[model samples]
Target: MSITARLLRYFAFFWILFLCAGTIYQYINFKHDTYFIHLKQTAVATGWYLPAFYCHIFGSSIILLAGFFQFSKTVYNNRPLHKALGKLYVFGVLFFAAPGAYVMTLFINRGGFVFASFFIQNTLWVIFTLSAFLLVKNGKIDAHVKMMHRSYALAFGAVMLRFYIWLFMRLGIGVDFENNYIIISFLSWVPNLILVELINRYNKCPYRTLQN
Candidate 1:
């Protein structure tokens, strides 16, 4: 593998480890946490928040685990297993994960443009994930792959959210982390989508854009 690819693989591995572990731990703790419970109780948005919250915790944990497998040379070549897991991944996002994310985004305590920006991104994540699924169903191979990659990038934003927050604190800009999150919200997936485009460009693959 090229040096860049090797470094990216290492980065992906560490991110999966860090975020997956944190998500699993936080979720298990959330099951008994009065803080989360109280937030659910006092918040008017529990209807979607609770489900989305758990979905994020559990679904993301599952995705982060499954993500490693998706890139595996063994599984990637095994179409049946790949398709099966991909279906599960997509289902988790469409019905459980992405929808829940949208709900939670609505209840973000940091009300303002940050909320608006996140909500917008959350909505796009849903659309992107669903569009990917439908493209696959319609037998649009290239589009399906591109859209799915975009969806996963948005899903991976959950990890980047934490990454930027930590970066902010390390830089002693803790108070401005909210602003940092807003920037990350847009940037996290945008670059991923752009990378997908670059990949397609390099491979000379034809894809159907959302405009199409």
Candidate 2:
């Protein structure tokens, strides 16, 4: 790797580590604190909340950080490790995180718009993951890469949500909390997809846009 590429890679590595560390800390804090911090009273009323919450939090944190190492060329060349990580990622999302998100969506902060944004985000997250898995199974490496890139972008939404919240707080920009969250619901993932699109275009992957 060139110097600039190495620098960018290190930056991305640390950034992902930061997000993963924050996620772990938040989950650990939630475990000891007792009640739901972000959920509405209605969601808390549901007995399924904690189980689903843990599933998404723990599973997503693993999936998010797993991507950082999985993308390494060295790891990719190591068939066993690559395959193992891929299976773990698929299991975490399909069986735990994605289902948890689907259930949790029913209880998001009030307003149809907020719910819908999150609904789409989680739905796409699952779809992208499955698509990546299926593509790789069929030996479509390029298509799989395209799909996985999209999946990671959505997975990173959890991290982006917190960043935006902190950014707003640091700016001392006061807005209705509910409205702000609703905006963040969409903002976190949409820009990520747009960014991936720009990368796909410039990088000129073997299968640009994953078209056959």
lDDT: which candidate is best? 2
**Model 1 misplaced regions, further than 4 Å:** 34-41, 44-48, 175-178, 204-212
Q: 1-212 in candidate 1: lDDT tens per residue?
A: 68998898788779878988876776675564645556666453446567667876788778766755765657866778877887888777777776777777767676576777667666777787789778777778677767766777777777767777777788887735456666755666667667766865676443333221
Candidates in order, TM-scores: namely 0.82, 0.85
**Which numbered prediction scores highest in TM-score against the true structure?**
2
Query: Model 2, 66-123: lDDT tens per residue?
Result: 8767778777777788788889999999999999898888777558988998899998
CA error at residue 13 for candidate 2, angstroms: 3.8
Which residue pairs collide, candidate 1? 52-100
Colliding pairs, model 2: none
